[model samples]
Target: MGEPVARIMVVDDNEMNIRVLEALLSGRGYTVSTAHDGEEALEKIQEEIPDLMLLDAMMPRVDGFAVLKKLKENPKTRLIPVVMLTALSDLDSNVKAVELGADDFLTKPFNKALLLARVRSLLHVKFLLDELESVDEIIAMTARIVEAKDEYTEGHVERVTAFALGLGQAAGLNEWSMRNLRRGALLHDLGKIAVPDDVLNKPGKLDKEEWDHILRHPEVGASILKGLKSLASVVDIVLHHHEKLDGSGYPDGLKGDEITIESRIMAIADIYDALTTKRSYKEGMSKETALRILQEEGQEGKLDERLVNIFSQLVERGEFESLGDRIPNLFNIPPPPPR
Candidate 1:
């Protein structure tokens, strides 16, 4: 089969320039679309995201720099490769475009050959990136399937993710750490899928062998995720979330410094959600009781003390109160204590 035709959006205020680019790109077997201004381009993007965007540097209402800034800030539009069409002498605009995440630049008084070449290169990169993103989506979908297994545990992952994010923000984690924490928290319980449903949903105390199977879930979850290269940073959190600082916890029994900060943060969130959330085996504990348990755990060196303190404060301030409403089965739970 022949190569697939790429969809390219050309955003220029000047009618002549738009026609020139549309004709040039269309002749090369690309499916071309045009927007007269940045606002129009963004609107069209919302309707259908193009594979590439050729944005004009200077427009009356919203300039190319402003549009690029918005695109880079939005997760949905951020990955669409953009080439800024600017005047040849506009070095400042060129620098600004790079800062705003423009993938490439095409100076005005365009060269058909250079434009086509840049378009080809950027589209190739976009195709590869879309492939990687597709893999990540598949992994996330698997996690959702695991969540769907136990009705009692519905929304458990969502609550943990929300609480972990609040804790990470309170602890002043950087963007990369925050991202890892979110992904790790969402998939932390993935290993539970390997446990038999009868064991997982048992309303009574677990026997020794049954408990061992439960304990192996962390390793099971890590094993499932370790095969994906994009999730490497998150595997440690999944594997060691149950570990304690005193080396008394399960799995690898990792001690202080041996555990990643992301794992440590996730541990606190996991415990809090597990305690405060109701299940078939036990009723949900009060927020005060859960906080007290977390405090005791931190004091005993099982969890990070500083992170626990931050999380407690956030809870007291009702930072995560709204999160309960977002989850499917958590709306009936009582609100946390106010500060």
Candidate 2:
């Protein structure tokens, strides 16, 4: 099939400007929509999001800047590429538009070729970004399938992701690191799919050979994700999440600072989720017990001391309570009976 037609929205109070953009874009086989002002643009956007927006900076009432601000604030519309239309002398407004997340700019009177070029470029970028989002969805779905294989620990990926995100937020990680941390946490166990179902679901303790197979999961998972460029940021977290600070952990046995902070944060969440989650042979431990085990591991140089401490503090402050409530099935595992 041929490439999909790009939808372009031109937002300008001037009828002439809108008509010019419409003529320029529509002739090039683009689907064109127009709004006379920012308010109309916003309403049209809410009704049906456009692939790209051509916003005129100087409009009556709600101008381009106001529209850009609203667009950037709304997560659903935030990623739609916006090219601000400005007058030749409106450098300040252009700068403001950039600050407000405008993707590109076009100065009036519009050059037909330049307008088409900018439109094509922004549409290409938006197409690539949309493709990347689809890739993310595929990865997330794969993670879910891996989780589905183990009925005993359903929602494990989600819980781990939330815990990792909480720890990452508390540590003041940058947006990039936080995003990778989330993807890493969700797909951390993706390699487990390679393990035999009998080995994975065994009610008895794993024998040495079975344990060896289990230990290969991190490497296997990392290998599976290594092919995707988009997942490069989080690949280490999947691979090294099992590695310990003291070099006692498996796969590459990365020690101390050799492991990425993303992996370190994921390790704490992974271990905590594993401890609190019930299995066929063992019941779920209480949150207190899980925290105690984590503290002990930190003391013994197994996990990152600082991250563990931060996670403990977050737990104490009930920061994860709301997340737990959202995924009640994961956190609702009953406590084991007293001896």
Candidate that would win on TM-score: 2
- How many residue-pair clashes does candidate 2 contain? 0
The collision pairs in model 1 are: none
Model 1 C-alpha lDDT per residue in residues 1-339, reported as the tens digit of each score: 644679999999999999988999999999999999989998999999999999999998988889999998887788899999997657888988998899988787878898899999999988877666565556566768888886778788878878887888888888778767777877899999999998888888999999998999999999998888778898998999999888988799889999988988999998998999898778999999999999999999888999999999999999888875666633222211111
* TM-score on alpha carbons, each prediction: 0.87, 0.91
Taking all chains together, the TM-score of candidate 1 against the true structure is: 0.87
Q: How many steric clashes between backbone atoms does each model show? A: 0, 0
By summed lDDT, which 10 consecutive residues of candidate 1 come out lowest?
330-339
- Poorest 10 consecutive residues of model 2 by lDDT? 330-339
Candidate 2 TM-score, true structure as reference: 0.91
Candidate 2, residue 271: CA error in Å? 1.2
State each model's CA lDDT, in order.
0.85, 0.85
